[model samples]
Target: MSPVVVLVGPPGAGKTTVARRIATRLGLTFRDTDLDVEELTGTSVQDIFVEHGEQHFRALEEQAVATALAEHDGVLALGGGAVLSDASRALLREHRVVFLDTGMAAAVARVGLNGNRPLLLGNVRSQMKGLMDHRRPLYAEVARHTVLTDDLDAAGVVDEVLRLIEQDRA
Candidate 1:
């Protein structure tokens, strides 16, 4: 199997951007769970939540994660809360997981005032901070490597991920 590299992080942590770069550098197919979910459902994530609620959206998110994990060769960027699901976390354990860690200020700035993020719609700063507190430990537990993204640009983060992949191979 071509090794799978899974990127997990909170919103605005540059997971998708870095995952895309890393996939390109490694000659792997790129897949984002959120994108897949949106594509499969034919609706924006915000619309899903507003129409069907979080529980419904999460069911779709879980399915997306499962499909991504089953792929033999690809870079997968998971939704921010995907790790919260036990089934999703279990599937991720089969891959090389990377946590793109960033601070609350950075996350807030990056995510901005996006109401599309259901969890981050109101008082996003505080919501983000709370998410970080809850999710950071889970990210650490699942990740084979952690890249601090506070100061790194997307390219720099991709470089770090590449180095880690090389190290693992060595």
Candidate 2:
């Protein structure tokens, strides 16, 4: 199987952009868990949150992660909360996982005040901070490498990840 790299981070941490560049540079396929989940469930994630609940959405997220891990050998960008699930964490441990660490301020700035993010609907700043507090440690736990994305562009982050991968290989 081709090598797999899993990118984990909170929303707006530039995981998708970095993953896309890394996948392109490495000549690997790119998969986004959110996109796949939406495609599979025939519903947008925000709608899923509105119709069901976060628990149900997380279930789909877990399934999406599993499917991506099993079927794809490339750079995969996981939903911000995917690592909250124990099963997802376990699966991630089996592959090369990179945590994109971006501060809440930067994340909020990047994501903006988007209502589509159910978790960030009301009091987004506080919610983002709280989520980061809870998720950052978990991400560090599963990450084989961590790249601070505070001021880095997508290409810079990709280069950092590539260097980390090379170091790990060595």
Candidate 3:
């Protein structure tokens, strides 16, 4: 399979939205690892976290990401926490990984205190802050390019990504 352009970021960084647009513009398939995990397990991510726990969910996520990297020749968006695992990070290193970086305020504004996000269910602002602090370095380590999404909309992010990809090619 051809190499993939993988999107990795914290939630609300617009990975999914930007990936879809980029995939359309570039004529590539769009695959979200979280969605793949959900489909394979026949349950929502929230349910997986609630019932089976984060560890289990992450195992499934690892598998999903590995599968996407190995078999997909397109745009792939990984779940926010996917980069935490060494296995996932190793897989990402071989692909064109884009890190959509967003500040805590922007992330909180975009994700809110939605119950859908199991980790941010309580004190979302603080949780998001902590998450960003913890995961920022990992995202940076695995990503070939880092796109700041604090002020960029989905279209703007896609535009920036396309520019960066073109630059990489050049």
Candidate 4:
């Protein structure tokens, strides 16, 4: 099955939240690969990263994304670094990928320096900056559309994504 909309972005770019709205608007189901990974492993992502490290987490993420992309013909939200995997990027090529972009300030405001995030432990802003710098190109490469979410609420993001998809169809 092919997803109607596959959202890819940085950690706090509102992919999960906006995906839900887009799914509802389009009468499609919503699936977050991150949540799926958690459900499959019966553990939080933070714990996975802390205990087994990023490589292990990425492996799980790869499996989760692959399964979702294959089985779900709806809206799928991938983890921030899920696109880093070459296999995931290849899978994304067959679907309508939307990159949800947000500025560092807005992302920080949304996510904060919480302990729940394993990557932003020492310095949130710096970590986010580095992630953005590295992953921006990858996101652009895989995404058919990019929606800026810094100034938009969840509803606004959903509207923009819908408009972009409609434009692409035309």
TM-scores, all candidates, are 0.95, 0.96, 0.98, 0.96
lDDT of 2: 0.90
Residues 1-170, candidate 3, lDDT per residue (tens digit)?
Answer: 84458899998999999999999999989999999988998999999999999999999998988888899998888999999899989878888899999998899999987888898888999999999999999999999999999988888999999998999899
Clashes of 3: 0
Would you list the rank order by lDDT, best first? Answer: 3, 4, 2, 1
C-alpha displacement of 12 in model 1, angstroms?
0.6
Worst 10 residues of 4 by lDDT: 108-117
lDDT of 3 at 16: 91
Cα lDDT tens digits, model 2, 23-126, are 89999889999999899989999999999999999999999988888998888999999999999899788899999999877999988899878998888889
- What tens digits encode model 4's per-residue C-alpha lDDT throughout 100-121? 9888899887779788878888
User: By TM-score, who's the top model here?
Assistant: 3
Candidate 1: RMSD to truth: 1.2
Which runs in model 3 stand beyond 4 Å of their true positions? none
